[model samples]
Target chain A: MTADFLLSRYPYVLIAVLFAIGLYGMTVKRNLMKKIIGMTIFQTSIYLFFIQGATKQGATIPVLDPELGPSAELYINPLPQVIVLTAIVVGVAITGVALSLILVLYRRYGTLDEVELLRRMRESA
Target chain B: MTSRFESIFLFVVARAMVPLIQVFAFYVITHGHYSPGGGFQGGVMLAASIILLRISLGEESYDRFPREAGIVIGGFGALAFALLGFASMAFGGNFLEYALAVPGMGAEELRYWGIFFAEVFIGFLVWGALVAIYDALESGGVE
Candidate 1:
């Protein structure tokens, strides 16, 4: 019974662990770059969760095979794959924008340490 | 930024590979209907090829495709996509109703064309936007 439960729930457990790690990194790390990396990790966990949900035990890939007919049950759900594709592109865009903002912040402040940057901002304000 | 690497091997291999990558990207976009590839995947691949050239060849890469040009191309692609959606509205149908937009074509055929054109526009938009982002990052955050 334990083995069966583990087999059925391992993917969710993995996702939860990954999300916890990302959250820890984002909240506990003081370096801005590390925080950005954490954000990436968080995004990755969500992607993995979506992909895991889309998988089936006996289903094939969501490709059309002439011999297989057009039965939807024969293939995995394609909607999640499509949504994840767009999510990945959006992730890249978000990362790029975040990095650019970090670049500007570093240029103006000369430090990537979050505490130091916050102090600097307070001084300026 | 104008520094060129002095490696003959890198230059020759990259030059040869760029065209092949571009051809494959086009194939992915055009054959998306029946395959695993599509507009976003192909566009990223196209952008990857250009970025490879930039990384290996340095400033000379900008001579072929300027940073400003990328932004303009990206804007045009977005405009094209929005205009296509609005064009459907002009034909007295809801947005993106491709059959009504192009009268006299079979509904299925119109849908096929609509998806194709949308993919093409998205391909261009993604390609140009990614390249523009790369350019901006390389320049080290807005002059």
Candidate 2:
């Protein structure tokens, strides 16, 4: 019975697992690059959750079909898709900026390990 | 980096594909109203095509679009978008209120043109900004 419930609600379960993994990577990873990868994974999970929520059984794409009048029920929710699209672009921009900053930091400190970076920060101060 | 990998096959393929990708990007931007793609997605694709050429052709890619032009184009795109918004306001409407942006045009036509122009500006901005970011990163050092 529990297995049946799990299968029926598999999307949420998958989302939860992805979120946990991303969180673990972000918090437990010691390398700065690893943290950036984790951040990307975390963003991926959120995008997946939003896109999944936007899906509906027997619903068509959000594009308007002239044959089938403009009925809200006939189409999947478009707002989430639109929002996620913008979010994806913003996420890319954020990642690009973050990577450039990391590159600068690496140049200055010659290390990408988080603990080492902190030590160097203290030494510099 | 460009000189390190000089393969005729890669060069030919990249050169051939760039134009096709650019054409598709324009199609996506223009047909966005009736399709899944829009300015943002199309703009990214356009940037991707140029980046592909840069990666494959190396220093030669700069001949197509000089490195300095990237940032200038990006700034221009953003300025165009802002000017459009302010133009609407100047015409006695709220910011981005397309209907009031143009005088004496039918409401529907005004809306269509407004959205079309907005998408074009956004496409230009995104394309330029992404290319500039790539150029900045690809160039060694923080200078």
Candidate 3:
């Protein structure tokens, strides 16, 4: 019974754990890459949220077919899939932009450590 | 990070798909209501196209769109969204209420068009904002 319960709630549990880990890393990590990784994890949890919300029992793709009558087994919400696609693109764009910014930071500061870079920047300022 | 052959293959494939991806993005943006896509998806796709260009061609290639233009694009998106909403009001409806905007057109079609146009603006805004943020980060460290 307990196993079944856990299985049913797995998506929520996963989201919570992923969020916690992402938040922890974002807060505790000093490396820019690590922070970016944390951000990615955080964004990924959102994608999971949308997907989980849109899930249905025995659902298939939202595509239509004349042969398949209106009475299909199920149909997962296409809205969420579409939304997640946007989120994924946003995540990738942010990551790429962040990486390039890091490259520039490294070029200017000669270090990837956020704290050290901040310190040098402050000193220079 | 992988072998040279794999890396080269990936690069070649990505290069080959840039135009295709761009076309797909436009299709998604235009026909979003019919499918599982909209302006936001299309916008991201557009940005992804530019990003792909950046990855494939490097920073030197991005000079095609000046940083100033990106900022303008961002503004244009906001303006476009607002104008869309306001235009509905001008047509004797509440803000963003597309149903009353164009009585001649079907309500669903009007909604679709509104969303599509808004998505265009959003795409431009998102792309420009990203470029600006990157530019800012590069010019000054985020301390």
On DockQ, the leading prediction is 1
lDDT of 1 by residue, A1-125 (tens): 98898788999888889999899989999998999899999999999999989988788989988899889888999998999999999899999999999999998889999999999999989
Tens-place lDDT per residue, model 1, B1-143, is: 43568899989999999999999999998889889888899989989998888888898988888878777877887999999888878878778877454557888998899889888888888898899999899887654
Which one wins on lDDT? 1
Model 3 chain B: lowest-lDDT 10 consecutive positions: B1-10
lDDT of 3 by residue, A1-125 (tens): 99998898998999999999999878899998899999999988889988889878887778664567556466667788877876786687678677877877887889988779989999989
Candidate 2 clash pair list: none
Candidate 3 ranges beyond 4 A from true positions? A60-125, B1-16, B59-63, B99-103, B131-143
TM-score of each: 0.94, 0.94, 0.70
Separate clash counts for every candidate: 0, 0, 0
For residue A79, model 3's alpha carbon misses the true position, in angstroms, by 6.6
Cα error of candidate 3 at position A104, Å? 8.7
**Per-residue lDDT of B1-143 in model 2, one digit per residue for the tens?**
34425888998898799999999999998888788888899889989998898899788888888888877877888899899888888888878887463567898888788888888888888888899888878885553
Q: Which residue ranges in model 1 land beyond 4 Å of their true spot? A: A1-4, B101-104
**Predictions ranked by lDDT, top down?**
1, 2, 3
